[model samples]
Target chain A: MTRFLLQRIGLMIPTIFFVSVIVFSLQQLLPGDPALTMAGDEASPALIAEIRAKYHLDDPLLVRYGKWVAGIAQGDLGISLRTQQTVVQLLTQKIPVTLELATLAMIIALTFGISMGILAAISRGGPMDYVARCIALFGISMPAFWLGILFILLFAVKWRILPASGYVPLTENPLENLRSMIMPATVLGLAVSGVIMRHTRSAMLQVLSNDYVRTARAKGLSETTVIFVHALRNAALPVITLGALEFGQLLSGTVLTETVFSMPGFGKLVVDAVFNRDYAVVQGAVLCTAVVFLLLNLFADLAYAAVNPRLRGR
Target chain B: MSPYVLDCIHPFARGPLPAKTGKTLLFAQQAGRIEPRTASGKATAWQSEGPPQFLLDVRDLRVTSSGGYPLVDGVSFTLNRGETLGIVGESGCGKSLTSLALMGLLPPGMSVSGQVEFEGADLLKLAPATVRDLRGDRLAMIFQDPMTSLNPTLTVGYQIAEGLIRHRGCDRREARDRSIELLRKVKLPAAERRFDEYPHQLSGGMRQRVMIAMALICQPALLIADEPTTALDVTVQAQILDLLAELKDDLGSAMIFISHDLGVVAENVDRVAVLYAGRLVEEGPTRSLFEQPQHPYTIGLMGSIPRIDTTSEWLPAIAGTLPLASDPPPGCRFEPRCPFAGDKCREESPDLAEVSAGHRAACWKAPL
Candidate 1:
C-alpha cells in the first residue's frame, strides 16, 4: 500500500510541470501584451518601455518561463499587475470563501444525492423512485446561474428572508455567513446531486442483482444489511470515482455560481485576471487548480484500496 | 409384501409417495449401525405401518412469475433425516428454482405456493420474517458460482461467521473462532490466514471451500447445494463433492444436492429426482433410477452422456431443448424430445405412477 501511494504521488510531478508550461504559454496568446495592458493604451512609449523592463518583457519566452518556474519553486507567485498584490496574497484571500462554498455544497450534494439514490433503488418503480428521478432531472437540466437567480428571487427578493447578494466570513458571524452561503451552495450542489443520484441508482440496481447479494439474503441478513452492507459497498466503488472528480471540479471554481451570487471566489479571481492579462495570477491559479485535481485523483485511488482489498498495493 | 410391492400397488400415485426401502440400505452402508432391511419380511413391516416421518415434505410446490406463468409446476418430493436427495435437470429446467423456493430465496415477483413442511411448520405458509429467521439458521444454501457467491469486500472469516452472529447472537470473538474452526474443517490450509483473506485472494476451489464453511457454520438442518461444483475444474469438482459429502455425513445434515452432472448426482445422493420442463419426470433410489430408468425422458438423459467405454462415433444428444417456460405442452413436457412419445402422451399430462418397488415415473406407459 505504501509503495502504491508513493508511486501515485511521484506521477503528479510531470503532470504539474506540463500544466505550468501550458498555462504560461497560453497566457502569452491572450491578444493584448501584458506590459501595454498594465500601462494604459494612452501611456507614452517611455512608460511602456519601463513597464516592459520591470516585468522582464524583453526576455526570451524560455528565459521568462525559467524565471517564473524559479519563483514558483520558492513559493513566490510574483505580483498581480491589476491588484498590485502578490498572486499568493490574492489566492489566500479568495481561497477560503471558495473553499467554504465548495465544502458546504459538497456536503449537501453527498447527503441528498446518496440517500435519495439509495431510497430510489430500494423502492424501485414506486412513487419515491419517480419523485427522485424527477428531482434529478430538474437538477441536471437547470443551469446553475439560472437556479441561483431563482433562489435569489424566491428567498431574497420575494420572501425578503435573505440578503440578495454578498458574502460574509464565518469568523465574523457563523449564522450570517451560513445565511449568505445557503443559496449559492444549493445552486451548485443541486446540479451535482442529479449526476450522483443517477450513478448511484444504476450501480445499486446492478449490485443488488449480483449473486453475493442473494447469498447475503440467504444468510438471513435483514433487508437493511443486505442492501447497505453487501450491495451498497460494491455499488459505491464507481460512485466514489465520480464523486472525487466532481469534488475536484467544485474545488477548482464555479464561475456561473460566483457571478450570480456576486461572491468573491477563486473562479472570479481567475476569470478577472485573464481579462486583465495578469499573467502571474492566472498561471498560479491554474497551476493550483491542476494540482488539486491530481491530489483528489490520488485520494480516490487510495480510497479504492481501502474499500476493495483486491486493489490494494496493485 | 415389501415396501416396493406396496408402492407398485398404488395406481397413478401422486402427492406424497411411499418411502424408499433403499434408504435403509443406504443408512446401513453409511452409518453401519442400522442393519440393511432388504429381506421381504422386514420390508413387510414398513408396508403395513403408517407413513414414516419425513424431515422435509414438499407437496405440489409451484413457482409462478407475476405474469402467472408457471416456472416450477407441481414438483413434490420428500427427504428423510440425514439423507441426500439429488435434483437433476438441464439448464432452465427449474432445478435451481426448486431449491430456491425451498430456501424462500425466490427472485422478487415470482410467487411460490404449496406446502413445504419442515421442522413441524409449512415454510411457504410462514411469514416472510419467520422465513428470514429460519434462513441461514435452520436452512442454508451453497450457490453454484463461488466466485460471484461471496462478497468480495468482506473477509472469508467474517462472511462465514455472519450467520452465527446474526442468528445465534454470537459475539465477534466467538464467531471468529468458530469461523476459523469451520475453515479448518473444510480443509483450507492456514485456516487463520484464510479467514482474513477476501474472496478474490482465494482460488476458485478455495473460494468454494470458504462458501461451504460459511454454509455449514450454522449447522443448518437442511443444506441446499445448488450446482456447487459446476463452476470448478474437473479434479477440483471431485474434491469439493467429496468434501461436501464428508462434511454432510459428519454433520448429519439432510441435503438437497442440485446438479446437472448425472455421474456426480449418482455418487453423492441417496435418491434422485429427475425434472423436465419444471416437472418431476422420474424419482427413485439413485441405484434403481440409474440402472432401470422407466421414464423416457430419464432414459434420453442417460443416453446423452458420452461414455469412454463406448466406441460409438456419434453421441446421442437429446433431440430438442427444454420447452419454454412461457409456453408448455398440455400433455407430457418431454413428448417433443421423447422417441417413445405416442398420441396419448400428447393428449394428457401423466401423473407419477409406480413402475416397480420404490420407483416412480410420470408417463402414460410406465414399466417401459
Candidate 2:
C-alpha cells in the first residue's frame, strides 16, 4: 500500500508539469499587451516601450517562458505591472478569505446534501424524497449570482438580518467574519449541494441493494445500522469523488460569488488582473488555483484508500 | 367429529378416501416424543401437540412481487427440531424467494402472505416490530455467496457479534467472547486472531465459516441456509456441509436448507421437497423419494445425478427448460419438461397426492 501511494504521488509530478505548460501557453496566446494596458491611452509610445523593456518583453517567447518557469521554481511569481507589487504578496493577502469561504461552503453543502440524500433513499417514494428532489433541482437551476442578489435583498434590505456585502477579517472579530461569510457561503453551497445530493442518493440506492445489506437485515439489526453501517460506507466512495471535484470547483466558483458579495479574495484578484492584463498576477493566481486543485485531488485519492481498504491493494 | 371439526378436516381430505386412522397414528409416531395423551380427550386435541419442538413451519406461503405475480406460490413445509429440510429447485424456481420470505427479509416492493410459524407464533401475522424482535433471537439466515454476504469494512468479530448484541442484548465484551466461541465452533483455526481480520483477508471457505458463525451466534431455534456451500469447492463444500450438520446437531436448531444440488440434499436433509417453477412437484422422506421418485420431474432429477457407479458417457437431463413463473404453461408447470407428460397432464394442474403411505407427488402419472 505504501508503494502504491508513493507511485501515485510520483505520477502527479508529470500531470502537474503538463498542466503548467498548457496554462502558460494559453495565457501567452490571449490578445492583450500588459505594458499598454498598464500605461493606458494617455501614455506615450516611448514610455510603453521602456516599461516593456524593463519587464523583458523584448525576449523571445521560449526564453520568457523558461524565465517564468525558473522564477516559479524559485518561489518568485514575478510582479504585477498594474499593481506594481509582487504577485505572490498580492495573492497571500487574498488567499485566506477565499480558503475560508470555500471550506465553509463545502462543509455546509456536504452536511445538508448527504443527510437529504440518506433521508430520500430511506423514504424512497415519500414526500420527503419528493421535496428533496425538488430542492436539488431548484438549487441546480438557479445561478449563484442571482441567488446572492436575492439573499441580499431579502435578508439584508427587507429583513435587516445581515449586511449585504463586504468582508471582515476573522482576527478582528470571529463572529462578524462568520456572519459576513454566511451569504456567499450559502450561494456557493446551494449550487454544489445539487451535485452532491444527487450522487449520494444514487450511490446509496445502489449500495442498499447489495447482498450484505440483506444479510444485515436478516441479522435483525435496526434499520439505522443496516443503512449507515453496512450501506453508507460502501456508498460513500462516489460521494468522496464528487466532494473533491466540488472543492476544486468551489475555488473557481468564488470568482462570481466574490464579485457579487464584494469580498476581497483570489477570485477578485484574478478578475482585476485579467482586466488590467497584469500577466504576472494572472499567471500566479491561475497556477495557485491549479496547484490547489491538484493537491485536493491527491488528498481525495488518499482518502479513498483510507475509507476503502480494498483500494490499498490497487 | 362435530361439524366445525369436520369442516376443519375437509380441506385435508380428498376423493372419497376412508378415514386414515392408521396413517394418522403412524404420523403421530413419526412426529415423535409426544407426552402421553392429555385428559381433555377432545377431538383434534393433537393439533396443539407443541410442534415436536421443531424449528420452522412455513405453510401455504404465497410471496408476490410488486407486479402482483406470485414469486413463491403456495409453498408449505416443516423443519423438525435438529433436522434439516432441503428444498431443491432450478434457478428462478422461487427457492431463494421462499427462504427470504421465511426469514421475513424480502426486499421492498414484495409482499408475503402465509403462515411462517416459528416455534409457536405465526410470524406472518406478527407486527413488524415483533417480527424484528423474534429475528436473530429465534431465527437466523445464512446467505449464499460468502464473498458478498459479509460487510467488507467491518471485522469478522463485529459482524458475528452484531446479532448477539442486538437480539441477545449482550454487551460488546460479552458479544465479542461469544463471537470467538462461535468462530471456534465453526472450526476456524486461531479464532482470536481471525476475529479481527476483515472479510477480504479470509479465504472463501473461511468467509463462509464466518457467515455461519454469525448466523449461529444467538443460538437461534431455526437457521435458514440459502445455498451456503454453493460458492465453495467440492472438498470445501463437503467440509462446510459436515460443519453445518455438526453445528445444527450441537445447537439443536432446525434447518431449512435450500439448494439445487440433489447429492448435497440427499446427504444432508431428512426430507426433501422438489420445486419447479414456483410449485412443489414432489415431497417425501429423502430416502424414499431418492429410491422411488413418483413425479417424472423428480425421476428426471434423480437420473441426472452423476454417479461413480454409472458407465454412461452422457448423463440424462430433463429435456425442456423449466417454464417462467409469469407465463407458466396452462396446466402443470412441469409439463413442458416432463418426458411422461400426457393429455391429462396438459389439461389439469395436479395437486400433491399421496403416492405411498408417506410419499406425496404432484403428477397425473405416478411412478407405479
Candidate 3:
C-alpha cells in the first residue's frame, strides 16, 4: 500500500511539470508587454526598459522558464510586479478565505447531497424521491453567479439579513464570517451537490440491488442496516471519487462566485492578476492549483482503498 | 387430501363461476388474514391444531407485478423438519421469486398474496417486523451464483458473524469464534485466516462455502438454497453439494433446494417439485420424478439432459421456450411446450391430482 501511494505521488510529477509549462506558455502568449504594464501607460520608454531589465524580461524563453522552474523547486513563486511582495505570501493571505468558503461549501454539499441521494434511492418512486429529484434539477440548472445574485437580493437587499458583498475572516469574527460565507458557498456548492446527489443516487441504487444487500436482509438485518451499512459502504466508492473532483473545483476557486461577492479569495486574486497582466501571480496560482488537485486525487484513491479493502491489499 | 374441492371460478372473485368458457381449475386461496401483530397478538394464540408439524407450509402463494401479471402464480408446497425439498425449474420459472417471497424480500410495490404458514403463524399475514425477527434465526436462504451472492465489500468473518450477532445475540468475541468454527464446518482451508478475507479473495467454491457458513451459522430451522452451486464448475459443484448435504444432515435443518439442474436435484434432494412457466407441474419422490415422471414437461426435462452413465446420440430437448408470465395460456402453462398437448389441455388447466400414495402431477394423463 505504501509503495502504491509512493507510485501515485511519483506519477504526479510529470503532470505538475506539464501544467507549469502550460501556465508559463499561456502567460507569455498573453497580448501585452508586462514591463510596460508594470511601469504604467504614461511611463517613458526608458523607464519601461529599466523595469524590463530588472525583471529579466529580455532573457530567452528557455532561460526564463528554467529560472521559474528552479524558483518553484525552492518554494519561491517570484515577486508580484505591483506590490513587490513574493507571490507565495500574497497567495497565503488570500488562500485561507478561499479555503474556508470551499470547505464550508464541501461540507454542505456532501452532507445534504449524499443524504438526499440516499433518501431518494431508499424512497424511490415516492414523493420524497420526486422532491429530491426536483431539487437536484434546480441545483444543476441554476448558474452560480445568477444564484449568487438571487441570494444577495433576497438575503441582503430584501430581508436585511446579510452582507451581500465582501468577506470577513473567520478569525476576525465567527458570526460575520459565517454570514459572509453562506451565499457564495451556496452558489458555488449547489451545482456540485446536484452532481453528487445524482451520482450517489445511481450508485446507491446499484449497490442496494446487490445480492449482499439481499443477504443482509436474509440475515434479518433491519432495512436501515441493510441500506446504510451493507449498501452504503459499496455506494461510497463513486461518491468519494465525485467528492475529489468537487474538492479540486472548490480549491481551484470559483472565480465568478468570488468576483460577485468580492470575497478577496484566491479566485479573485487570479482574476485581478489576469486583468493587470500579473504573470507571476497567475502562474503561481495555477501551479498551486495543479499540485492541490493532484494531491486531492491521491487522497481520493487512498480513501477509496480505505473504504474497499480489496483495493488495499492489492 | 380429500380428493378434490373442484370449482370453476373467476380469478378476481371467489365462489362458483358460469363455467361457460375455460378457466375451470382454481387453487383455492387459503381463507384467513393474520391481523397485524399487536401487543395482544399472544391473546389470538393462532387458533391452531397444536403447532403444525410442517416447518414451512406455503399454500397458493402468488407474486404479481403492479400490472397484475402473476410472476409466481398459485405455487403451493410444504417443508417438514429435516426434509430436503428441491424445486427444479428453468430460468423465469418463479423458483427464485418463490424463495424471495417466502423471506418477504420481494422488491417494493410488487404484490404478493397467499398464506405462508410457518410455526402456527401465517407468514404472508405476519407483520414485517415479526418476519424480520424470524429470518436468519428460523428461516434462512442461500441463493444461486455464489460469486454474486456474497457481499464483495464485507469480510467473510463479518458476513458470517453478522447473523450470529443479530439473531443469535452473540457478542463480538463469540461471533468471531463461531465464525471461524463455521468456516471450518464448510471445509474452507485455513478457516481462521480465510475468515478475514473478502469474497474476491476466495475461489468460487470457497465463497459458496462461506455463503453456507453464513446461512447455517444461525442454525435456522429452514434454509432455502436456490441453486447454491450453479456458479461453480462441475468438480466444485460436486464438492459444494457434498458439503451442503453433510452440513444439512448434521445440523438437521430443513432445506428448500431450488435448481435448474436435474442431476443436482436427483442427487441431493429427497423430494422434487418441478415448475414449468411459473406453475407447479409435477412433484414426487426424487426416484419416481426422475424414473416414472408423469407430466410431459417433466419427461421433456428428463430426456433433454445429457447422461454420463448412459450415452445417447441426441438429447431430446423440449421444443418451444417456456411461455411468458405476462400472457399465460388460459389452459396449461406448459401446454405449448408439451408434446402431448391436446385440445382439452389447451382449453383447460389440470388440477394437481394424486398419481399414487405420495406422488402428484398436474396433467390430464398422469400415472402413465
Q: Write the per-residue lDDT of candidate 1 for residues A1-314, one digit (tens) a residue.
A: 88898899989999999999999888877798888888897999999999999888899999999999999999999999887899999999998988899888988898889999999998899999999999999999999999899999999999999988899999999999999999999999998999999999999999999999999999999999998888888998998999899988888768889999999999999999989988889999999899889988998898888898899747
Task: Give the per-residue lDDT of model 3 (tens digit) for B1-368.
Answer: 11111111112112122331122122122211111111112221122347647778899999998788889989888877877888988888989999999999998778899999987799888888989999998889988877887888888899999998898789999999989988888899999999888898999889889989999998988899988876775556666876887788798898899988665565567678998887898988665566678999888876665433455566567788877778899898888877787898999999898897567999987778
Binned by DockQ into CAPRI classes (incorrect, acceptable, medium, high), candidate 3 is medium
The global C-alpha lDDT for each of the candidates, from Candidate 1 onward, is: 0.85, 0.81, 0.82
Task: Highest lDDT: give the candidate number.
Answer: 1
The better candidate by lDDT, 1 or 3, is: 1
Q: Which regions of candidate 3 fall more than 4 Å away from where they truly are? A: B1-52, B309-311
| Candidate 1: true contacts recovered, fraction | 0.82
Instruction: Please give the C-alpha DockQ score of model 3.
Output: 0.64
- Which tens-of-lDDT digit does each residue in B1-368 have in candidate 1? 34443222121111111232233223223322211222123222113357777789999999998899999999998887777888998888899999999999898899999999998899998999999999998889999999999998888888998999999999999999989988989999999998888998899999999999889988989999999987876557667877888898799898999988775675567788999889999998765787789998888777766443447667677887888889898789999888888999998999999887768999998888
Docking class of 1: medium
Ranking by DockQ: 1, 3, 2
Candidate 1: which pairs clash? B4-B357
Of 1 and 2, the candidate ranking higher by DockQ: 1
Top DockQ prediction, candidate number: 1
Candidate 2's residue-wise lDDT over B227-306, tens digit each?
99888754476678778878987898878899887655655666789998889888886656766889888777666654
Per-residue accuracy of model 3 over A230-291 as CA lDDT, tens digit each:
99999999999999989889878588889889888898898888888888999999888888
lDDT of 1 at B151: 94
Query: What does the lDDT come to for candidate 3?
Result: 0.82
Q: For model 2, what is the C-alpha lDDT against the true structure?
A: 0.81
